[model samples]
Target: MNRSLVRHWIALLLLPLLAACGTTPSSQHYLLTAPEAPLPQGMTPSIGVGPITVPEYLNRDSLVKRIDSNSLAISSTERWAEPLEDGILRVVALNLAGLLQTENVRLYPWHPKRAPDYGVKLRLVEMDSNAERVVLVAEWFVYRVADDSTVARRLSKQSRPLPATTQNGNEVAAAYSELLYALSQEVAASIAEAQGNPAAVSAPST
Candidate 1:
């Protein structure tokens, strides 16, 4: 056979092998979810939670875990179904809605005319899991928008122990959800303090 013919025949024979090699394992996607519960039946000021920021490194769709204090690991086969910041905002809103017993919950990017009585700001300082535990740390603030005042400020950090036998992202996602719930509770306490004032302010929902 000519050189070109020989090369063509070889390429045809390798096609199936290349196709098989191209098949990759399906990735596992995970979501952060809070406990299922009812919204508070009572009427309250509208609440806005937003501008929750994450580190540039943690902004990717992949799930991240700590290797050591200075090292980290990104899972190629495990990923987030949505942006991590959005997930955190959503879970925090759900948690606050249940804890505050008010449906006046909102996420960020509030309507121009809709100003929330209070705003929740959060910065994700650290979020990582290792073989033993998952840790979440944030610097948060509660603001009174009407007066442009900061009503509360806190540095919140939470750690949850993972089961020794835990082996997947679901467990880690669950742990993150729990940590978010706990953090929302802390913000709720601050809101409760702000609610004592006679101002009529509502929160923003995204």
Candidate 2:
């Protein structure tokens, strides 16, 4: 091929490569955090948190924003450091351990010997963030593992205003963390109340 023709083809090939490189920005990955500090030591029951579920739309790695009641947008450059459900489960477990001040907390599917006294089952109905606020809706149950008897069941609908300083994915993640922390408080209280711990009966819920 002629030199000019070969150079023209090379330029055409490089054009797409350069354009692709310019359009694909580096993604920012964020993680959901648990409460900063554990609560005071107390006689909390052995608790299990999990078999938790989230919405199908939230199963992806990207962060989501609600455009309106019917519309949604998924970010290309903002993403979760891990799966959303995994993050939720991990943070809930940690928060419970902290709130209850006991080392007997376990995730779902523990060995028969290590089975917790109370099993916490949660299903997240909605988890979304927008310019104004973050919303989390969850249905949860606390049951006695030994007798397979239900202790507490509740559906929690919670919202927190997005930080006025910023409404990025990081801030949204922080809001999610706070919601999960509140949920842990309710779960811990249920377990404690069942175990006859007076202090936990008054623990707050979201």
The local distance difference test score of each candidate is: 0.86, 0.85
Highest TM-score: give the candidate number: 2
TM-score of each: 0.87, 0.89
lDDT against true structure, model 1: 0.86
Q: What does candidate 2's lDDT look like per residue over 12-55, in tens digits?
A: 98998899989887999999998566454654578888899998
Best by lDDT: 1
Could you tally the backbone clashes for each prediction? 14, 0
lDDT of 1 by residue, 1-206 (tens): 79999999999999999998799778999999978666477657678999889998899999999989889899999999999999999998888787777788878888868888888999999998999999999999999877769988989999999999865899999999989988887888788767784332223233
Clashing pairs in 2: none
